[model samples]
Target: MRLLSREIKLCSVLVFLFLFSLKVLAQPPAHDPSKIMRDGDRYWTFKTELGIGAISASNNDFSDWQSEPSVFGDTWPSWINTYVPDFAGHFWAPACIFLNGKYYLYYSCSTMGSHVSAIGLATSPSLNNPDWTDQGMVVYSDGNNTATVSNAIDPAIFKDDDGKAWMTYGSWFGGISIVELDTLTGKTVGEKTTLVGGNHQDIEASFLLKHDDYYYLFVNRGLCCRGVESTYYIQVGRASSVTGPYDGWRTFLQTNGRYIGPGHIGYNEGRLTYHVYDRDDDGTAKMMNTTLDWSDGWPVAVEVTQDPPGELLPDGTYRIQSFDSTKIVGVANNSPYEGANVEILDFSDDNINGTSWVINNVNLHQYQIAPKNYINLGLDVYNCVGDDDANIGLWSYWGGQCQKWIFVDMGNKNYQIRSALSNKPIQVNGTFESGTNIVQMSNNSNDTTQLFTLVLLELEDTTYNQYPQVVSYSSQQSGNPASNIIDGNNSDGYRWSAENFPQYVVIDYGDTLSISGTKIWTYQNRAYQYTVEFDTDIDFSDPYIVDRRTNTSAGQPITDNFEPVAARYARLTVTGAYDYTGPWVSITEFEIIEEEIVGADELTLNDNTKIYPNPVVDVLNIQLPAELSSGADLAIYNMMGQLVFRKTGLKGNIELMNLSNLKKGIYSLIITNNKTFVTKRFVKY
Candidate 1:
């Protein structure tokens, strides 16, 4: 199962729509977009006005960005347009959040030059499940029409270190005001208090950051929203409390080069993500990011380094969890049937019983999910329908297109699973209910029910019959010692080499077993030639040369397969080198392979049989006097009688067996499972 999630396709469509609207209206969506909110490392910029398009960036880098599908429909959720006719339906200065499995987007809506604006809220559980519902207006300015009580637009949510949340919003009409927020629902909980005010000429965009013992208030001052002519710049002030008559209102960041209107700052980690009107490009707003250099307790913006998007798992089984609740997503015992439902639960006794999922990659980080135990079962579309709200279920795998899924990574390790067949998302039918069945639904915004996390599991081990024991080297160089090769460390610093040509290393396997191949890793330098040989005797009296390398050197691990040979000892001898220093042999890792046939060895088959080529190199001829039995077996064993190779079904009078797959060694051949028997001895030389 693929452990990767990102909805690049959905974002592309959203960007196209935004660009299309820009063409029709002949105007940009929002002027100088506001604060950047990040979930884990994923970043977004919600444009001000109407549809409030949220564009995306990677590694918090806004360079050449992405746009989420626009919330189109007359540019605003239809539910609120009736309440505020003069509201302009323009969603602006949006502040986003993921709290309790829901995304609370607090935004501003107002007409041209009107302090009579409203800060409305929208809620979504999954970013990929774009079902953003308006939570109605939070708090808008209703006081005297003067700058003192000005409450118009520009909203910012400040979450503090103590878990308390507050909001600061307003434009030039009234300065900035702070209000406590209801923790359960991100809306105004009590009356507001004024923090700072000025003549409606130079103030707006309040961003709060809790650093050290101070709450730093950042705001944009002067005329904004005039495209390349906008003169807005950011300034900052700090207080020990959220509401305050603060100090140090100095320039935070200003227009540079082709950048203008540098405001609406959001601080994460040590960097600040914001936007600016560009005189370059198309004279539209572009996202800009930077870290900060601090001096005398104030800050200066420095250049930033962006990171690439995250990667998928290296390929393995993993347990899927609900990112919102930390619960495991698994098939309920009763739900393993075709029409059964899937659930996310809080407890588990056995992970492999049903929790393990096999990830079959479809493409581009998308995968088909199946249970490890129920190997043929997959997440499927139930009773298949092409309309809205189709059902989801687990069923016997028939390789249907509906079984494919893609994960969209919501920041903070959360993922939304979308079907490759329907292009819809899967979400728990309800809230964090322990055993809710997952259903397919359309995405509008963030919803907790649709999120999941893929976690890794330990791998099972395999057993080997024989392995290399003692290693003897002919000679070694001073710095490149022979012992380094067998140390089991392939790091650059550890390796082995022979100082002179005609150098060799002898490896002894404690007992004789059929050796099939050897794997080797060499140093970076390409200058040596070598050959591998095996023999039953230590001195290699009649050594069988297994493989050879003439004059080239390559770095990666190389595997050379040969005819299976029973050898207690094997040797690698270097014959030549081209290094300027001298002829030297270097190796990082060397592995010997033992070939074993599982249930392939049988000594007898019904009736008479004759075998030719006592010592074979490529093909051995087997002759049968009459027709053979259905289950007739052919197996070869080494001198030690260990089954090395075998095949089922024997027929025809003259049957040829390819001996090229076996290592050169003395061996016994057997044919027959029951009824009758045939046995003989042969050697692959």
Candidate 2:
């Protein structure tokens, strides 16, 4: 009866969605460009633009600088070979965390069978290292014995505030499941619990995060992996515990203007958000889509804003309440041909507003012509081509005829197209050259005797059928010799060594601190020579070498203990190599635990203090009982260390400052009046 019910439900879904049973094959489509997002200084996004299909990882390897943005758009560095060999596959759904000085990247891979789906683990001391050690399969589900769905994929790992490690995974199964893990070893420790289950179709690519004592579970639903037909969308539920009978299941797509199929919720800038799995300009299925917002209890489609407590628009969009555009200069088109109409065709919507002249209608006759002539205009013409038959045609009246035939100012200035035949209005001899003379001429105003016809044309794609490329490095170099090779490998003189080094931890002297302990981990049978260097500058030269240590031992973990020193920056230099080269050593983790030391010192100064009302709407008022000292600095910094305001001391009893420019977040106020230093924290709401 259960089998019959399953068959009946499948038939009903097919009928409702009007899906055909044509033995469809799920293959990576061409022109899959995923949206890219910025995480701090590094850009993290799925690599679909290169048309390489679903990329598993971006190969960020220090030794292999070329490994970044992995050849096939996979961010996973090639270094995993140093640890796991069965790591080869279309591995995707990467969740990375920096814990205990090591980067743990958890991802999943699958072949044709649902039971074959498995989650894998890889670790690297650095994100940009080619040396990733595959920790092997963390979990696997075969359809025969496991749950209804054999696909055990989409793994997300997180450590709670209490120092407990947890992983949530599963897809097309009953629902999402949460499992506890042994932190020391990436192995499951507790029994898997069905956190949430329902009749709704849930393909678990669950992202579990805690906010305000609530654990949020984000899951993907409906059909996914279909290029244009993928009904990928996101839903959220919250529970007080990691493994919960989560309530408040809300579908973000139910909102207006809300796009379909948002999946893979990732924390961006410390906020919960999901990726939009939608069609690209060419209608290709893209795994890396735009970001969605989850500020409110329910998920809303919103833009990423640096400001906290931003507003959610009526259309479910986010507005950066604190963004100031008054200081920005508006883009103006000064060229005479700015308003001219240019016919564009055959190009995908992605390239429509770009600078490239990718036109439709591959045939020469179908090319688009500029709406107006390039008579008088000073503009930059980009990828447009000229007509072979005409010497002079319509041109804008700009300084040079070429300038008249300029492309419009598109964002990023990459897809602009200009007429190819525009020439200088004034001839060399103060006379325009008659027909067909513009051909073979350079940008010479003195040769104005040559009249030119500006014509629009398109170019063909050159990188068709080309597989992603990677650089092969020679193993003879040592001590990060590859670091010098910033560009592509060319001259043997061009290649440099790239190595991973440990970063030092430091504490300020102003704070009374007592060092409790220090821990370090060295991976593989690697010997390392460590030197403690100190200097104000981070340069290698002129460093004060404080201490050094060398380990000739060959084995697995190594531990060292030492006393702590108060310094601004600690420098750790490794020498002896391990694994692949000479004196190679990779430090997996280094930590320094400290405790606060209390002291008793008495100093007092009498001064006037004044603050405004408890609640401030637009402006905040500050008053002083006495005139402030000259040259004193008043500054306001946000929680993220961004300076929002700075001013000098003024001789006024009361000061009115505009708080409208500030975002709804916490800020620190530093006022240096006379010789006294004062610091206070305030909330801007």
Candidate 3:
């Protein structure tokens, strides 16, 4: 009975292998991951590890995962070492796709920081029981060979709507390039076409996706592999076809708080997969997933704001300096009283406390500026009047329109701080000496007194607001396009006007948002009857309308607040004019305001709880109130809202915690129990 014994042993080995793979792994560290593949009830994805490791998820749960077998195990392709001879046992940026009932996996093989690389291919029938057959190298790069000199790495395969296959591959040496491939053989059939160049030589990791009528190309740029200091971010461009002339390059994702860098994007099954370096956890790369929303025919990552390169002023603590480098904005004589005059003064150590200001983002392209020593008082225009030469003062926060400010980027880190109430830039009153009063004035193209510089003290956690963009409009006059309405400018030269009665503009904020109101600034001070409509779809089918017809007001800016509604696309239709009945309609700026919603789970401030040495180093001491003397739950989260430390069932009022292992960044300490919930911010060095 030898045959029967052998069969029993073989069956037992298969059963053990299946049971071992059932253990779920929490947060499997993956880098340069491929688009997830599916086999029956299991999902599979490959990543760059020891010769390309694979992971799987079962029962339709995409987050819970288990480590699977490596595609080649200890035996890699034999032809890899022949080309460059610096081949190692590791791979980089693997990509996979299914074609003709077979899976084609493409990967990169290269040395560190070099262009002598190659892109290889392998095929398998089933991922659940993989038997990958090496198909040799598809493309390579050489220093001496003129035929294949392009740095070939990060191979991403895409199947067009017409059922033709193509591969997009390259690295820093030649930016990103693409070539057509035969669907049957999974090999290149045409000459490679260079798609786009990188910013310097810091761009790589290209991924291509086809949605609707356009082909979107995603790439990574800036420094990488530097832990918390990595500047890697994602950029996107789109073209009508799969090949040349890809324009409209825009920043898609960026470093937000403890999430240092987000790159290497893959799309599958209505969701996107990428990796972000977690600064709270020693800058480890972790996998992240998000969905997409369309705004004006372009894809925007859901719930993520696009911080435009070189133009965005992130929320933080800064010192406001005028065009004169030695002078800065401060309270007159360092006064702590409300309604104190804000004046420009010379920089000195005694007046450093008055120069520190906290800039908080209130809306899209808007901020609420306040002194760091007194956050309750904010910069405001006196009397709330909308006119030129309005004096600016430090006043208590009353949620007035004059307290809200808009920062207009004038390039080179210089900004024109404009008032939201008057749409006028704040100037130094035509003087540069000490104690010069700051006032609001008319727009001037070449005024240095109006431009101010923001010197950052530290990078802090910032909230996000989805960027609203103008996508479509009914009609526009020459030299004044529809996009000027959302360019964060209210000047007369930057406006959209048309010689028609029924001209309209549509703005897309990417996803469905809780819209509360609209701030419309027209070209002239004329009364106009308009109707605002909103819809979740691009086409205004079954829209929520806010009709403002039969109105009689001639205000420059008409602020209309309505019932909160969920919408994605907002349309403003100018029906008729009341004061001047002419065939002309113009709009200078349009802003959709979001409604703020606070929940009961929010933290409540407690005066009894005191934290010592706010900019603490190594150790942190927390003195809890008498109400929290009993057992409580303590948690510390990074700026990206990621929990880095948690201790449950903590007792006593004075708690001494060691934080020597944490990185140098900002953190929020949260303490909660059955009867108490408190939160505080501290710095770690």
Which 10 successive residues of model 2 have the least lDDT summed?
A: 4-13
Cα lDDT of model 3 by residue, 1-685, tens digit: 0000001100000100111012211345677778778876788878877668788887332556778888877668889988657877677788999999899999888776556778899999988988899999999887443223456778889998889888988765556789999888889997888787521133578889877889999888654555554556788889998995677666788765446668788888666777776644655666665567889878787754322212335567889999865789998888867789999988788877677888765433446677776765789999876568889899755334477687777878688887755567899987788998999987684998899998998556432222354544555676676767877888778888877655667776644566888887877876887878786544343468777776677676788888777676787877668887777788888888877543332323356777877677888999987666578888886543335788887778889889988875566677766643666767676
Task: lDDT for model 2, please.
Answer: 0.39
Candidate closer to the true structure by TM-score (higher is better), 1 or 2: 1
lDDT of 2 by residue, 63-101 (tens): 111113432343444543433344443455656665666
lDDT of each: 0.60, 0.39, 0.70
Identify the leading candidate in terms of TM-score.
3
Off by over 4 Å in 1: 1-34, 38-42, 62-64, 75-79, 304-685
Clashes of each: 32, 66, 0
- Pairing residues by index, what is the TM-score of model 2? 0.35
- Which candidate leads in lDDT? 3
* lDDT (tens digit, per residue) of candidate 1 on 266-313: 666455666665543434565555566667677666643211112233
TM-score of each: 0.39, 0.35, 0.45
> For model 3, what is the error of residue 332's alpha carbon versus the real structure, in angstroms, after optimal superposition?
20
